[model samples]
Target chain A: MLDLFIDLSLFTMLVATGFAIVKMRRLFGVTMMTGVFSLLSAMLLVTLDAVDVAFTEAAVGAGISTVLMLSTLTLTSRIEKSPVHTPWIPLLVVAVTGAVIIYGTLDMPNFGDANAPAQVGVAAQYMERGPEDMDLPNTVTYILASYRGYDTMGETSVVFTAGVGVLMLISGLRRRRRRKPSRDEGEVS
Target chain B: MPEIEYILGHLNYWLFTVLMMTGLYIVVAKGNLIKKIVGLNLFQSAVFMFYISLGKITGGTAPIFPLDMRIDPATVYTNPLPHVLILTGIVVGIATTSLGLALIVRIREEYNTIEEDEILGIEKELVAQENRTLGDAMGGRA
Candidate 1:
């Protein structure tokens, strides 16, 4: 009973936060609300017994992303320009897509049903064999680091690529500034 | 009634749908580029919720084995695959966010505006100028 209450309350908060994110015009408010939204969803993940996901959500969703957005805001404008066009078309598109997704969900197994396909498939074998293979108490760590090591390596490379891309985009300003003096000397020559 | 039971039993999914649609609306309806990125983040996080909730078992605890590292055959463990998968997703989401913000920085530098409509207008103006110049070079109307 209490669990149900917690779920409903978190869901309510999540919906409220999402609406708030849409309505806010100040880009700063929207950014902060996005962080709050991540934190709220992290709480919901906790109730759904996804502590690891909750942790990652809180850290990445709320923590690093918020900081990055704030710094980005430093480079860009803090106030959003009010949209000139009517939003009805986007609203209609969203409504149609959402209705179709809900219709698809009608066939999904109930929340937390033990016999759900996702819980039974290769997941069953992972839980059964992970301990013996990796000897780790936390199955998530074992699966992420050992069983799916190659995938995690790929994810790391993606992070590296993104880092390099960011540097390529924004990190040239200081270097360019330093080279300006040399360019002036060449021009004078 | 079974209908009511069905709706109530899948409360998680209903809420997930609502959140997903809300995020989608923000992405589509909002004109500001940063706001669109925020919407994209919301959409991805909503998907993370859906997958994590699906992996949960009603009575199962977290997937950490007992301190002694002994496996009990009957002990129920919530699926950890989704959790592992979501970790990768969360990291990728950050990478995408940062890269997007960096690109937004470049967009602002070039266009001096972050509004999508305004950016489109600037690009259109540039294209028209290029077309006019090319027309003059081709002995057509300047």
Candidate 2:
């Protein structure tokens, strides 16, 4: 079955990511693997009838996020050596959260059930009435730019703020470093 | 064909979720900034896949209404809305990437390294020295 292949490929990708995360000594490998993981997820979104989400994810998550992180890495070290200690606290927290999520999903609807409340209720209305609400043909656009316009606008602003903050922080550090090298070198104290 | 339709309809989602979670977990667990961003990309792509798959309609033509045809409820229409949204997102994504990369370059020039732990250590030392200087200015030596 096509599903079997998809499942197998996804599983393989996950295993590879796990191995890379464990075995790779360089931070660069981790960054690349993260991108690969995002791309695979986008492919899956296409399968789930969530094309709009997949597009955003591929573009923003895999593309933009990787670049930003890589830039930050340029200012730091590229590899993390085990310091003879494992972080058991974080591991325990993650395990608990994962268990809770899996347990919660056990009672959830089967995939793509047309009669599910989510499918039959506001979602269907959003799909059906979307054309009427916005002059645009894309229902997702209507939902993002009109129905949920405020959220998108807020997200845009948040991104703008983040860009500004990172610039300012780095600029300040550069100034300090410049002063340190020149003033200390000249003082001869 | 029947089997194909069934597989296409359901199994793809499992693939998408697994990859998505893997990326998310890495992003959250990894301390390296670049690796975290990579994980972020993976997470976002999973969401994109969800949008694309919804547009598929069995035996349906493109959503474009032929100029000759009037309103007909019987016409099977492929979903086009998600595609349009995705186009816009792709453009935004590119902008975000360039901005992030630019920031990374700046970060490199500033800190002289890209490792999170080392950067934090340096930052902490700087802060500690600054505090010491401030205390000395007030005649309170720690």
Candidate 3:
């Protein structure tokens, strides 16, 4: 019952924060709300027993991303210009997509069902043998660093590529300027 | 009683749906490019929530083992796979955000404006100029 209460309240705050983000016109306010939203979701993840994800969300979403966004804001305008186009079409599109997703969820397994397909597959095997095989206190760390190391490597490369791309895009090397001999000589002419 | 149970059991999914839709709305409706990127981040995080929720067991503790390395057969542990995957996802999300912000910086430099509509308008004017020059050469107005 307490879990449910925590879940619902956190979700309420999340939705409220989302609505606030959508309504705000000031880019700074929206950026701050985005950080708040990430932090709230981090709390929700903790309730769902995903401490690793919660940690990452708090670090990356609320910490680093917020700083990056604020710096981006410095390069751009602070307040969003009033939109000339009506938002009806986008609303319709989002509503239809949301309805489809909700309908799809009808056939999904009940939350926390032990017999759910997701809980029974490879996850079960991992739960059964991961600790014994790896002898690690944190199964998440073992799996991330040992069992699924290849995928993590790929993810690292992707991050590196993204960083290199950002550097190339924003800050290419400055070209050396050529100067006339007279200017270099400082009034010798 | 069954209906009430169903609703309670599936409440998490419903919340995920609402968040996903809200993020989608922001991405599609917002004109500011930065706002759109923020919305994309939100949408991706909602997906992370869905995956994490699916991994939760009713009575499970976290997936961490005890410090002494003793294994307890009766103690349930939530799935750690999703958490691992989401760590990679979180890193990727930050990478994408930084890359996108870099692109926005370039766009601002080129166009002197970050608003999507104004950028499109400027491009349209450039296209019209090209068409007029080509049309004169072809002995017809564009």
Candidate 4:
């Protein structure tokens, strides 16, 4: 019963935060609300027994992402200009998409059903073998570091590429350095 | 009672759907590029929630086992695969967010405005001018 209450309240806060993010025009408030939304979702993940995910969400979503957004705000405008187009079209689109998803969920297993397809299959093997293989308590760590090492490596490379891309986009290559010196020499002459 | 049970059982998914749609609305309806990015984050987080929720077992504990090598056959553990997958996803999401903000900064610098409509207007004028000059040189081919 307590679990249900916690789940309900956290979800309520999440929806409220989502609405607040959409309704607010001030960019700063929206950004902070986004962090709050992440934190709320992190809590929800915790209740769902996703402690590692909760940790990462709280750190990356609420911590690093919020700082990055704030710094971006400093570089950009803090107030969003009111949208010129009527929101009715977007509303209709979102509503239809959401309705379809809800309809699809009707065929899905009930929440926390042990017999759900996701809980069976290879997941059972991992849960069985994780401790025996790695001698570690955390199955997530064992699977991430050992079973899915290549994927993590690829993810690391992606982060590296993103960093390089951001650096290039923001700072750019100094293509005119030689020309600048020649122009200065001409001026001196 | 069956209907109530159904609603309660599926409540998480319903709420997640609502959150996801709200994010989609912001992305589609809002003009500000940064606001759109914020919406994208919200949307990504909602999807993460959906995946994590899928891993839950009715009476499962967190996916960590006991450190002392004590194996309890009766104890249930939540699925850890989704958590592993979403860990990578969250990292990638942050990377995307940063890269997007960098692009936005460049766009702001070039156009001196981030409003999508204004940018479109400027581009339209530029294209028209180019057609007037270059097209005339090509005997109005363009």
Q: Tell me the tens digit of each residue's lDDT in model 4 across A1-189.
A: 898899888988998999999999999999899889988999999999999999999999999999999988887788988889998999999999999999999989899999999988998998787776889888999899999999999999999999999998877424443466788799999
Off by over 4 Å in 4: A172-189, B136-142
Candidate 1 off by > 4 Å: A175-189
DockQ of candidate 4 compared with the true complex: 0.87
Q: Model 4, A80: alpha-carbon shift in Å?
A: 0.7
**Superposed model 3: Cα runs more than 4 Å off:** A173-189, B138-142
Chain B TM-scores of the candidates: 0.93, 0.77, 0.95, 0.93
Once fitted onto the true fold, the runs of candidate 2 whose alpha carbons sit more than 4 angstroms away are A87-89, A172-177, A186-188, B1-142
User: Which lDDT tens digits does candidate 1 get at residues A15-111?
Assistant: 9999998999998999899999999999988887789889989998899999999999998999998889899999999999989998999899988
What is the fnat of model 4 with respect to the true interface contacts?
0.90
- Clashing residue pairs in candidate 3 are none
State residue A97's C-alpha deviation in candidate 4, in Å: 0.5
DockQ of each: 0.86, 0.23, 0.81, 0.87
| Candidate 1 chain A worst ten-residue window by lDDT | A171-180
lDDT of 4 by residue, B1-142 (tens): 8898888889889989998998999999999999999999999999999999999999999988787879788998899999999999999999999999999887886677888898999999999998889978989677
Candidate 3 per-residue lDDT, tens place, A13-49, comes to: 9999999988899999999999999999999999888
Per-residue alpha-carbon lDDT of model 1 for B2-93, expressed as tens digits?
Answer: 88778777878878989998989989999899999999998999999998989999889888999799778788888899999999999999
